[model samples]
Target: MINTKKIWYLLAAMAVILITTVALMSNKKEVEKTPKNPYQAIDGAKTNSYEPVGESLELTTDDNVIGNKKAELIVFVYEDYSSPYSAVLAETLSRINSELDNKLTIAIRPFVTAGNNISREGALTLMCAQDEGKFSEMRNVILAAAKEGSLQEGGFNVYANQLGIDETAFNNCLTNEEKSLKLEAIMAEADKNLVIGAPTIFIANEMIIGARPYSDFVDSNGDAVEGLKAVVDRQLSAVGTKK
Candidate 1:
């Protein structure tokens, strides 16, 4: 009664503060409820988070293999020649093989996602190189070219000549019906395994779908683990235990 106007003013101010607080709380809840991107990778980082595919890739004698066949672990990689990610993976796997003391067998199969002659030609060229014992060399040349954006569909013969792959034999192999059949069979096998993209890797019956660095293979927390190396370690440990 003595100061009714002042009391009303104070009440109105308190109401405004309460409304603001409630709105802020509601917004915070909304933010907390939002989902995160599962495949979100760190910017500029070479490592990637992996999803587990609970299936094994059967290795065959016809598969283009690198590293020692007697290795305890076999890793199958399905890659596209025209994909930069596959190039990254080739480097990563090479490093991993070195770090692991050549304890891995890396089998490579081509999955032509680029849908062009360059990719198909590259794949066929690799098969030809394999016959000539120059698979690794030709693969390196192709990877380098792909990385540099200089890979040409019609330029495979130049690479063959540079690598001393017997130009005639390489050209004949490239145009061979048998090579085409083998590639088709490989593509069908990849499709059966649900390979959706390039650089898909299979280790210890788990599928990793992109190029990942060795560091990303393990988790920092020591409990939550996801990466190429992490899965490989687990498989190695299990194999050791079984032995």
Candidate 2:
């Protein structure tokens, strides 16, 4: 009778230990399965605000012209070559230019987003094309290829050839240190402007921060005149305040 009692007590203790162990493991798994906040995940990559204080800088190549210039209207675009949103914005700008009869002057600056996707080589290739006066054509080809999802290995070279850019010159430019520095400077300037994402558009002084619909630019009359007027008014207001 005493031996039976001892066995019963031992079994109860063993059962309690097992239950406690299982509960701890279950609680651990629940802790591990908790979801993370998406916005908090990107906290390390935020851009710092920078204002260009003097005369606007310009980058000129034989094929492309980019910079701060006085015009009836100035559209500043911050783009990343590997970003789909940027590609769409490029297409929209092309369409707008065609429909508006060249009423807008556009300035494009490169902002690197994808890790080593739009590299120094890519930027130099663009600059070389600009030197050859084939910047727009080359840009269109690249954007179209990106839209088609074809920018794999050696694809940029193929597109350059398609746009009639001299492949040898492009290759040389891609490896040139001076050209690399220029691209780095452009990227730094983009960083200074607090460009946090690809396809950030600035019309006059107003900023539109994403790949929004083209219709966003149209007014009630199905024309972009109102949009242009808004930009003009903002610019005038800025000038008045400066004085």
TM-score per candidate: 0.72, 0.61
For every candidate in turn, the CA RMSD to the true structure comes to 8.6, 9.0
Which portions of model 1 show Cα errors greater than 4 Å? 1-55, 217-225
Model 1 residue-pair collision total: 0
With candidate 1 superimposed using the best TM-score fit, by how many Å does residue 61's alpha carbon deviate from the native?
A: 1.6
User: C-alpha displacement of 95 in model 1, angstroms?
Assistant: 0.9
lDDT of 2 by residue, 1-243 (tens): 469989999999999999999999999999899865222111211222123332354434321433324446667787666666778877776666656566566787766664665533455567777778777777777666667766664457876788777778777777788877887777777666556677776664355566645542554566443233333344545665877
| lDDT of predicted model 1 | 0.79
**Residue 130, candidate 2: alpha-carbon lDDT:** 75
Q: What would the per-residue lDDT of candidate 1 be over residues 1-243, giving only the tens digit for each residue?
A: 569999999999999999999999999999999977444333222344344433457778778788888888889998789878899889988887888888899999988874678888888888888899888888999998898889876899999999887888888898899989999998888877667788888775456787866664344645333556766777788789888
Instruction: Output the lDDT of residue 64, model 1.
Output: 78
Clashing pairs in 1: none
